[model samples]
Target: MKYSIRNILNSRSKANGNFFMEITKILGHKPKNTSIYKKAFTHRSMNIKDSEGNAINYERLEFLGDAMLSAVIASHLYLEVPSGDEGYLTKMRSKVVSREHLNELGKELNLLSLVESKIPSGQFGENIHGNLFEALVGAIFLDRGYKHCEKFIYKRVIIPYVDIETLEGKVISYKSLLIEWCQKEKKTFDYNVYEDTGNDDVRHFSVKLSIDEKVVSKARATSKKKAEEKASKRAFFAFQNRISQFK
Candidate 1:
């Protein structure tokens, strides 16, 4: 007895019912291509390969989704804020699509619950949720095109969450503001970062923030960027009154 292609497809369809239901609940729409959704949730640790021998995982989709998200957000900001200059629009888009914000959005939706992976979710970092969210966006784009993807973003992101007036005052990075203030005030500022190769399980970086050639603040974190930013934030608070006058 030989099974037809239709029979194989039907079997797969039956197996994917639960996944489709979960996706529908999250997306507020039924997924057109279930395979795309599968790839969205597939972790690199699974090491699965497609018929073409290419790795089946979310990383590539995450990259595509990130670009798509930026484009959609930029377009929306452009149309809504007709008076906003390039810098203003760019900053607004950054606030909307920031990694921290994306992570929060993913967590709110409990996107991790749908992930298919060999590694335990507890072993994953906070960024995993954000990454998975991006992958899902990419899958949506591939399965339904830009218009549908935009609709999804607008419904899931823009409608309930975005408030332009509130976002204008929001500080995406206090460190960036501090650096700009230092530059404007003609005060020499530098971040001295060095690797902390100590006995700790996670490798870290230490940062010393120097203003006018004097050490003002210091911090340490798992990443050099984060350590430097933390040091800058500390320096900013110490000189808040002085810095506020610059702008």
Candidate 2:
């Protein structure tokens, strides 16, 4: 692959003094090991490799960050809602760390502005925001250990967003809600999804959500799962009153 001046400049920009300042602002303190943060924002598309020939990218860090987030959020839910049993606590934690929520957090911070990727930013999907957020958390854990990581999570995530009552009503998957309601009501539900090779390079899928042999809602998305979910959400809203009756 060829490298343009823009790509070269972008790589150099990651290490400049101003970049650290921007990071310090988000982290609420100066970072000791800036390279980890650099890794956090670096996308796998760059194909960077370490001296040991190990791939150097944010994916591993994202995994670590996800675990840390789960642990911290679980602890918070455990203490805050003493009466909640295992199932309730698990669901609450899932709501807090849901992809949509993390993506929103990353976007609110403008974290993607710091990312280094071979592909244009326009090509990246919404999940990139959450991926970067998780990688940043992992970098924090590596740079300053759990205490600093916890502090950053609380400041950025928990204190600002986590609310017990609000979270209780939050729906992580409208598809799950619709399925539960259907099962309870003894109604059959199905998502008929088909590949939609549109003009665009990205493959798409179209879905028709059927309830009791009647098509209730239809949607199209980049993936079958998403298409099904979009259709399910629409169907849920279409029958909102009926679905809510199960509550």
Candidate 3:
């Protein structure tokens, strides 16, 4: 029996083609240039460099993606809510594009599965998903142009996820709300954050939420901002009825 080299090469090429097809199915479009996608998934820890010795990682793409997301989301909100003032539209866009929301979207689509990183996924914080989502958006923009990028956002985000009524009521930052309420009520408020210096590997912060010189709530977290935010959230719920009237 004669084994032909050409036949073996053709079989391998066919397998590669099938792999790309699977990736296209996952991405919802056939990739025009695979290199863009490759760069999107590359992690900074890998220390990859381009032809000019410039760092080649997702960070730059993430920046571009963030701007692109804001633009698309802003346009959508502007057109959909005709009665919405600038402030209202901006808030609505923020609600949709918040880091928490983006992270949830990325996780739902398993975007992290495509990331190329030296660090273990378990070690990464929740923001990794959001960052990767932004990078992917940037990649799509570069590979396919603005119109295709807009189409992708419309299909993946607006069509399935956006509900104007639901978004309007969503709270992106309880801390901001608490502060606003305090200001409106002519009451003084402060977040006193202190180092926890606990036995845990991660540093911790303790926060006391003071309303009118009295401590309303106390909480601790891995970061001072998070601790303060948690305390403020608790303080808000404690005064929910009063806050609702102010809103």
Candidate 4:
């Protein structure tokens, strides 16, 4: 069991080789710079730094990937739906790259398994999956350029999930929809949120959605946003016939 720098280098090379294969399968092409891909999955908790003493993590890549995703999706929607106006195109692109949809894509790829983090993966929030997926896109753009990045997005996002008719019907946020409807109908709506004690381990918030000074629906969730959204969904259904008429 004698150890040397050569043995350590060999071990690391073997690990990177396996990683390269995995990335290739995901990208549909070999990555030019494996180190960029490595940085994509490196969590801030690791406190990694480059030789220049600059912090290294996925956050920066996440921002870049978000922009890239938006640009590519917007371009696709623009060409695909020549009839769509600015608002329609914007909404369609949002649906295509929504947090929920991105999370699903990340889960499908199992990208979290590659993360280099000091924190346990289980402790991460649901957004971590989507974050990693975006970071991977940023890495692809940096390593292989926009052509490869656009191709990857088309394969993973546009080809499988994107359908003009389907996306038009998709609701990205019930809360936003509810609010818009309220405003359009000239109805004053309020979300009254308060902490709700529960036997479950997680703290909960209860929300009452009131429209026209009448309590329309009530719901509870671990977060106020979720609680309000749940209540809004219930309220939406409650007034579905009227809302449909407005639309």
Candidate 5:
């Protein structure tokens, strides 16, 4: 067979073209600077660097996107919930942009498929999906501006999921909820977390939630936070009757 150098280059060009189309569809507009979008999907493990020798990855964009989400959501809550006080508005915004919700958003968009990472995508934690989604939003803000970013947030987040009643009951932090309940009733609560690696290859943690020195619940998970949350959730259900009275 004859060597065809041009054929390989053409295939590469076509791949790039398709990637741009995918990004345009997601953003609802053509990206002005393709590099920014690329950076948004680039993982830190990839270890890319700019000509100035600065590390290039989605971390910075994630930070910007988090702020942008908070700002836009805060604005929407302010306007939509006219009677909501500072505490109410803040709580509403947190529910909307919580890590769990962001992870869902990222999964819905399948944003992880575009990430350039040295690590296998399967090995990544659930937060990576949300992290990349935030990076993409940050890229949009940088590439276009705040208006474009706000529009995307409205289309994907606010318009679809910002029902007042739904958000009011949504649990952003089960652990926080459990602690608050305990405090309200003048009960002391503690999360006794300890390492509990079993036969699994990954290390795990176990937690026992004690309320008033009584072990209310015990749970296990890959991380201390997850184990504590699991324990708290169990504890909450166990004390649901009493908690309802305080609520």
Candidate 6:
């Protein structure tokens, strides 16, 4: 019995040591509170609870990190683009903190490798990467402070990816753009979505995007939103010349 306890303790000690080294490299500074960092990578499936019965996971931290990211990015935009109006600044910030962009950043950092969960890692969706990234930001905030959080964002997000010229031209959401264009042109549009009848093991959804009662594009994906986005992308290219002018 003593041997088993000792072995367990040794294993956890080793894991914590490795985690500290990895987190230090990522943060560019040693974490004062390592426990918070662990919570950041914890998956809800683990069902962990603290002494007061509060659930221990990354969800709450994700929320904090998201707000921090927005604040820092918004502040940078406000100072950098003095001529930008409210709408312009808001849109620019949205583009910078878009889900797709966050996912890309998370993937680049390989944050998924640090997650602790009861479920298989392969079963997790792509958004998990972004969630972990945000949780890390939250952990940094709690461990160090706002300044450290801002510094990390500048290193990971601003200095590397925030370019006004490129961001202005980037289309974060084709669906939003298509809808806006249709609204401006006073054209009616419809998206006929339904379950795909494919024989693949994974169920799928299909979308047919019609503009002005004429089918402009058809696409299929694992979810309704993805299928719609795919259709919207095809439709965007179809009406590229006109849409470019409208944009």
Top TM-score hit: 6
lDDT of 1 by residue, 1-247 (tens): 5223233235557646777899999878788777888888889897877655678889999998999899988988897799999999999999999999788678767889888789998899999989988998999999999988887777656654455764797666758888899889999988889998587789999989999999999888899889987787667656643212112
Per-residue error for 38 in candidate 3, Å, reads 0.4
What pairs collide in candidate 2?
Answer: none
Q: Across residues 1-247, which tens digit of lDDT does each residue of candidate 4 receive?
A: 3223223235568777777899989987788877788889879997866656677789999999999999989988898899999999998888888999899789879998888789998899999999999999999999988977888887777765676755877677779998999999999999999999677678999998899999999988899999998888668756753212112
RMSD in order of candidates: 12.1, 11.1, 12.3, 11.5, 11.7, 11.2
Backbone clashes for every candidate come to 0, 0, 0, 0, 0, 0
29-140 per-residue lDDT for model 2 (tens digits): 7889777887888888988776556777899999999999998888888888999999999999998999998997898789999887899998999999999999999999
Steric clash pairs (candidate 6): none
Against the unseen true structure, what C-alpha lDDT does each candidate score? 0.80, 0.83, 0.78, 0.83, 0.82, 0.84
List where candidate 1 sits over 4 angstroms from the true fold.
1-15, 170-247
Indicate the residue-level lDDT of 62 in model 1.
Answer: 98
Report the alpha-carbon TM-score of model 6 versus the true structure: 0.65
**Better model by lDDT: candidate 1 vs candidate 3:** 1
Regions of candidate 4 where Cα sits further than 4 Å from its true position: 1-11, 170-247
Q: Residue 67 lDDT in model 5?
A: 93
* Model 3, span 92-168: residue lDDT tens: 89988899988977876677776767998779999998998888899899988888887777766666556675587
Q: Give me the candidate number with maximum lDDT.
A: 6
Model 5, 22-132: lDDT tens digits are: 899998778898778878887889776665667788999999999999999998889778999999998888889999989978987889888877999889999998998
Better of 1 and 2 by lDDT: 2
Better of 1 and 4 by TM-score: 4
Model 3 clash pairs are none
